[model samples]
Target: MSATPSSKLPPFDPRDPLGLDDLLTDEDRAVRDTVRQWTADRVLPHIAQWYEDGELPGIRELARELGALGALGMSLTGYGCAGASAVQYGLACLELEAADSGIRSLVSVQGSLAMYAIRRFGSEEQKQQWLPRMAAGEVIGCFGLTEPDHGSDPAGMRTYAKRDGGGDWVLNGRKMWITNGSVAGVAVVWAQTDDGIRGFVVPTDTPGFTAPEITHKWSLRASVTSELVLDDVRLPAAAVLPEAKGLGGPLGCLSHARYGIVWGSMGAARTCFETALDYARTREQFGRPIGGFQLTQAKLADMAVELHKGILLAHHLGLRMDAGRLRPEQVSFGKLNNVREAIEICRTARTILGANGISLEYPVMRHATNLESVLTYEGTVEMHQLVLGKALTGGLDAFR
Candidate 1:
């Protein structure tokens, strides 16, 4: 199925009847409308089958289209990027995730994690090598940070890279829970250097570099996740990202990824909320519309309230980021609050369907399950708390 001929993409119709425009700037609205149109055309019509098949075949091509629209790395400046405002990026995220969190995961990892990592840390040569292909979706990239034993505490990561003679390096370690690992043509891997932790751009074909797809996962099934095993992989000095140093380097990338999650999760919540609302309005209870009752209204009301607040929080944080005053802890704050609220919204929306919620005919259950992964990854719930606690008390005690 193709998108309706309508050039606009607000729910069911365009023209701002819902007044969501009040939440967006003109630029943000334009970006959102474009992505929403793309998703409706490319994703929604085919998603149920893809969801059933457990894979989205068009993801890579869809990513390239997003890149052309400047949706990929839109917030980043220069190097063939959109360089748009962070608020606009947030709106793009919302529209993409409104389609599915798994697809949104692809965008966030490519744009925020992979592209941002290279742009922020890599040497000029490395950026020139990867950023252009990535922005064009010609080469997919994944961030390899969490290890088998270091999901919650990456500093404890055992992956190590040692400098050999002639500016060459040998890397050995396993990276766990890597998104896009299976399909990525490039991987941004962090390893412990003799001096400290450092990041590397390891091509997937590097000898001894292998990523085995993780299968039968209940969460984020439509997205690819894999374990990257680096068995004495060799790299040139150019592999090292020059500007990023210390723990802040990888953590900085996580902060960028989390900001995208803040917006993306709201899209997931909105989908489930809307599904539940429509169900309530049509699914008869005692020969009366469930939506007419106070109980169903209460659930819809809560979902709306939470989704609205999450979007506002993400939108405000986007402004701060554009101002260059946003702190890592602030990113953590949005990641923590919005994801939690979105998960709750999904759960409540799922309950509105009674038994039908668990069925694939509805998206609430899938969104809820995927939200579980969203909450756990990208500096888990407790880790964000530690970050926020440190911000206030100057103490980073909890996740260390």
Candidate 2:
């Protein structure tokens, strides 16, 4: 049976289906609106070009602009941060990522991983020294946990830090696939120690610290990805983050960033869906708009269902986070479901766009490719599945 196209299509609202917009408080709506407009004005126009060029020029200027908008470290309290609620932070992430995942990646690495580490585990002096500047975007930050040999199994990481005769810490390791690494002023690097895994705040300018840009990437080309090499890098005893011990510290930070991915992935899917919808409404095939075809309509319907549901899940998780009731396993659930579904949505949208979908002019392909990176980062899909499996099995350890 052929589906009949309605004579008049409803106004497109990819991010807000099921009247979810009505549920947002005024502040939440305001936060979403602000980021939406900023992306429309500043990002959407140039993001494709930036992605194609494989670099975002004037990156520092863009960082400052994000700071001025109070986007950097927006959810964290004090230290020149915005102290916005988790929902607002998630909304901002959605808007930014709707423009491009690269943009969202910048904010996530800076705020969720680096800044949050300091705020959650750093001493007052460490926080005072870095958080303010990082929140203001005067100094960019990166988190170093994933290494060349150890990604899924960080416990087996070879990167290690040792105490010198003078009581200073000497770090020796390499971190790979680090976002914002090349541009970072400071790196929150985690390394194995005799006392178990520990995190250290190393200035980029410190002796023996080098961040070499990783090029030729197919995904996240607009973002700065790099390899962090610490060849006997020396840091003061104060540089060690006093509170973060063992794998829990870096895993905690990954949870924070993964939460943002829950929302950001939906944003990317939304862009692809909207773009595909607009194209289907106009492009003709067999003397009718392609959207009039039953097949295309089915694709659109499925994409819409997943996109909206992902947003709803993100909102629920955000509320939990704001209330301090969120759990790591819950975050894992959201990340696994949302990101997996989002990539599916993007791929479906790309099919709806047909051959044009593969082109950067349409944004469908770009978003789809970016989601490839999104799916793997923070926590891989398989890893999250194990987490949920453990949760269901009464804390049974499955990943032996």
lDDT of model 1 at position 267: 92
Runs of candidate 1 exceeding 4 Å displacement:
1-20, 394-396
Predicted candidate 1 versus true structure: per-residue lDDT over 68-168, tens digit per residue:
88877778888888888988888888888888888888988998898999999888898888888888888889999998888887889999999888789
Q: Residue 70 in model 1: shift from native, Å?
A: 1.7
Off by over 4 Å in 2: 1-15
TM-score of every candidate relative to the true structure:
0.93, 0.96
Give model 1's TM-score versus the native structure. Answer: 0.93
Each model's backbone clash number: 0, 0
Q: What lDDT would candidate 1 get against the real structure?
A: 0.86
Alpha carbon lDDT of each predicted model: 0.86, 0.93
